[model samples]
Target: MGTVWPDVRLSDSGDEAPTSPQRSHLIGGHDSKSYLAICSESAVNWLKARVSSADEQSVTDIVTRLSRHADYKSTFMCPPKLKQFPEPDMQMAWKYCQEYFDNRVETLFGAIDRRQFEARLRAHLQDGDNSDSDPSWYALRNTIYATGTRLLLTRTGCDAKTIHESAMQYFLNALSVHTQVLFARQVDLTGVQALTIMSFFAENLLGSSIESMLCSNAIRVAQGLRLNYEPVSNERLSPSDRFVGNRIWWALYCYDKHISLRDGRQSCIDDDDISCALPERQASENPNKFEIFMQMIKSAQIQSLIYKKLFSAAGRRQNTIQERAAVEQLDQALSEWRDSLPLHLRPGAPIKKSSLPAGVHIDPVVYMHYTYYGTVIAMYNKFPWTARGSSLDNAAFGREKAVSAARSVVLATRYIDTDMNTTGCLLFSYPMTALIVLFVHILQNPLAPSAHSDVVLMDMATGHFAQLEFATSMQLEVQFVRDMAHIARRAVEQIRRDAWIDVTPFEAPEPAIFSPTMTGPNLNFMDFLTDDVYAV
Candidate 1:
């Protein structure tokens, strides 16, 4: 008899059947080649002999079982219905919409047209809860409410639990209409926008693989509408409409590339298939307004190149010399892109908070800096594992760049003024990656001048994660980081004590211990320590 797989349905109503009866096969095994995976390997190797048996087991659980794939099955279940509540007053509704536009618009690359959306929102409000209203618009409106409410939670001064519950209510309200919009006979751009917004919300709040699935759907819908192609002169769209279309398409493009990179999956939209033009600045618009959005598009393009040239299966097959050349070329491209940014917006440049326009939040600016440094880290993160023999020089260069970039990321978090609970999971990933690098760096050379200071930075990052745990459901991931920090602290203290006498320098675990051939999918805790499964 064939192996039996559990029944998987997409809805509670049992209206959707499983796409395949067999369980989904693991593509690259449970572990991915993402920075987080690299971090896990480093932690396990460093903590192998330093911690108690129970602590070692804890590390093993986090590495082998706490991955996103382990919980991805939950995504197929229908979202539970939120308890009904009175809708916010029209004044509050409009305020929430404004908050989303003022704060989130640039981060999402102007996913919605402000004037057009506001006009539609006014008309929707006039309809006064009519069920006849377009479901796509209804979903989009609620998602805007969800995003805005979460953003304002810190300022509200209400109980954090109350505010979080309210935000989740709005998110569920938007999801209530998702099926209608998804299965509509004639899917429109409005539906695509709704899906995209909801996907963003899901990523930040829900913390699941569902966000990627929703984004893939949005990409498909946009492609079906031919949004990937530049409009011909004969298509007869107004300049404003063309501009909105361009923004939406490029925004989806950026989201697709970033999500793919984050999840270590193939991108849904291929660059070769896209001919959409980048959004152009209108004559009346400030050049500075376009600066962040344009740079983000460029950043996304670079991310796409990085994955294809360095991380992809074909890229991985390249010999040491070829890979080194590719890394150098990509590094130069990234630097040139950074050099092209405005002075204040450039990574590590100090910005006066007062100079920001009224109503504009500092989150987007901070995120841009984080992204730049994170990209740099991502480019060189694999060097310690992959470097050997003739590649040691390249490894040294890569290590220097990666360490500096990681330090910059950890230091840059000081500028985040927003409540950590309200920020997305993506924000935490960068610092965690940096923390891992710092952890390994300390283990390698505990007596380095910066090692003690780096430990302080690691503590700060752990505190940041503690704050984040209040709102996020990703307890396993947060705990993993905290546990690693504990091990690192203990290890460093031991090294400090040994440094007082005639003691040998601490040496990093040999890279051969992490070879994939020595490990497989069914390893026990001790086995895992002996042969790290997360190695590239």
Candidate 2:
């Protein structure tokens, strides 16, 4: 494939373009490798010049020219034609489907124009029984209906296993429909919405690779259409079009930041390239979706920076002191954001707990708190104190703070609306990072306050990962989150064995997930009178 942007290495794993040979508009009639070289030289020099001072005119020109390249036009520039899906009227708009999303999913992601969507569906139905259908709208329709049905099933207490099976079927069926539509036509705005919905479902189902791939495609398509630019500021669009365009852009932006954090990779979309502002809320808006989503994007962006600078292979310079300072600043920033949230949205602010005994119906605040604490643990864990010999070097308050934050995260999970909302579950590494820090603490200081309690929490957290695995989303085949889960389990098992505790091993014997650690006695025992209490 020809280079889409010769100046930039867009992703760590350049999973953007197909690999097969094909003629491109930019390099038409030229040999593939030779044209690639020629284009690379030209684009790189242009980009280098623009980097020094890239105004709106220059950036727009660059994106415009690149969007026309036949090689990646589908991925980044051109919109695909849409197809109609013929669902029974009953399935088209089930009772309270939109209400469920407005109450739950909408609060998390404000990427869709719910009112406009319903209006379109109603108009399509009213057009006439004899009128030909528009297949383009079908993908979005099915995705929307599928999401609403899943949430509805959970809230209504369809059997626990039944809910899982039924919701999975709805999502899978929609996925099939969406895939076929895109394969048959170019990707359109409705297709982007459907893919975003699928990405949400992938994370909720604990699917690792699929979630990332879906978001990558969604963002790629959004950029192709230049949704990253301010629609209202541009004269080509009306006020309503501007509103819809900004909402989609911000939603895609948030999703990309999330996928980057999950994979510990640099973000696929550069912050410098985005010109759209965060979506604004009207005074009468009830749910505050705009505010929450805006803050969530900011939080995810901070976390993504943490992942890239401290964890990614390309960023392997482990300056503990420097990274510690960065983490501390982020911790403070998160706390400030939480404090600014409205009373109902803030953690521990009495969000529907007294109203419902069942955990399925919840205010989105519960998950927000859980995620924030988990992020805190991820930051605190980066200190050298987590390694074996750092016990004596570790400060009491820092470790105490970490333990408290870990427990807060553990307790918050109980109220996490498992059946309806799985926002935090999408990023399995967040919880895994918390549990590993606790594991490190226990291994380093076994007799500390409630030592086994930490181990118990880690064990419980590992069980939350049962559903996360390699469920395919199109052709993506990586098990990124599942790998983290396997590593966490083995780490917990090792903790038990090293402490001379009973270990019920994994059913199947296999190679260790982590390379063997070179171990030797590093701590001097307190030679005591009783001896048995300290024995290991």
Candidate 3:
């Protein structure tokens, strides 16, 4: 592309134009690359001359000229070069910058409007055509996504509101087209476009229109889909698709009103206007509610929508209210037990035992669910649990399922201890059932480690606890057994120790050794534990 220069004539127009016209443009407005270079050069010049006050207006005029070029206006803002420009009075620079940007946006829109860009693009979409199946479709859409976002952010001097509104309209339209393409089973189109759209939104407009655009079903569809272009007879899919899909879907719920691990307001893309989405933290209180909300979304019930549905569906096959009430009783009991622990003593408390910690700690609830149930639920939701003639075998899977659950309990324990905190028994103090539910909730979390400690399992189920055990030990079972011995000796040696409480035997059961038989689908561990053999 050649640079565009303004043609000028002398008052002696009657005379032959000077051998060459005095072209008064910053750099010849030419190809996109050149335009970018010129704009960048002018921006630098404008920045350098500031200290000396050498022709500030002239330098500004050059910048204005660069901004006036069509290609430069579109592509120059987001590249690292523009962002790195020496800090200028951005607000003040707008006086000249505004004229340059206003002209650029007006020109681009004028061309688009005149050419009816949307109308032309819409022609490509045919009913049942499966356009999303074409990778090129997303390639094109991504280009628009990047270009449109750049226009919103870099277009100087434009009303922030107007730019924001226009950007949102384009985003919404893209989302609509994306959904149509996905439902039409153009997997290729939906996959690429959706991912590009998501990546751009996450990277560029994360706080504002991008996130809100995603909050709707658009995010869910984008995350749920696994697009494949490679030919495979046996339904092979790329890891990237599954990974992106799960992340996008998980992110939607991750930020849902219920999840509380992080302040939603804080999670709001800082640049975007998420004031309406994020609740304000009060001055006087800890902003732990958001963390609590994060935990709920990561919970098994929400994470494993399919299993939850199956659990609900299985309810219709049950025999009596007494049987149903038994399960309900356990959940209610667990909830009550959790409520009784002090906040500091609760799961996810700091290992340091200080009034202040350097960084915020993970919410026990979010960490537990996301580690355990979230991983499995996310996987099972996308992949079929049963395929033709492998014949769904819940019976055989039940024991493995129990192992999986136990592993999750162990894993959540490890995660809570290793990653979230190195020196806290906070999660270990939870009731066995709450621990079990929390374990179930996190059984599927991909981020959770497969490895877990046998000792932590023992402590969570036992009542023997001491400050030393609490502060000193990393493994719950080791601490439990240790505490039990000390308690027994103290009570035996001194009646004063007995005044506090009687010593009890340690009854921490080994992992998955005595899983309750599933009465259809729900395992009744309470009944199994209350049985004569387990008691002995």
Quote the positional error of residue 2 for candidate 1 in Å. 37
lDDT of 2 at 119: 79
Of 2 and 3, the candidate ahead on TM-score is 2
lDDT by residue (tens digit), candidate 2, 103-178: 5554345566667777776776576352223333555665556566666766676644454554554554455565
Clashes of each: 0, 8, 31
- Return the top candidate by lDDT: 1
On a 0 to 100 scale, what is the lDDT of residue 237 in model 1?
48
Whose lDDT is higher: candidate 1's or candidate 3's? 1
> Which RMSD values do the candidates have, in order?
10.7, 16.3, 28.7
TM-score (all chains, Cα) for each model: 0.79, 0.61, 0.24
Best by TM-score: 1
Clashes of 3: 31
Global Cα lDDT for candidate 2:
0.48
TM-score of 2: 0.61
Better of 1 and 2 by lDDT: 1
Cα displacement (angstroms), candidate 1, residue 346, comes to 1.4
Q: Which stretches of candidate 1 lie over 4 Å from their true place?
A: 1-31, 38-55, 61-89, 105-108, 233-239, 355-360, 383-394, 418-426, 444-449, 470-479, 496-536
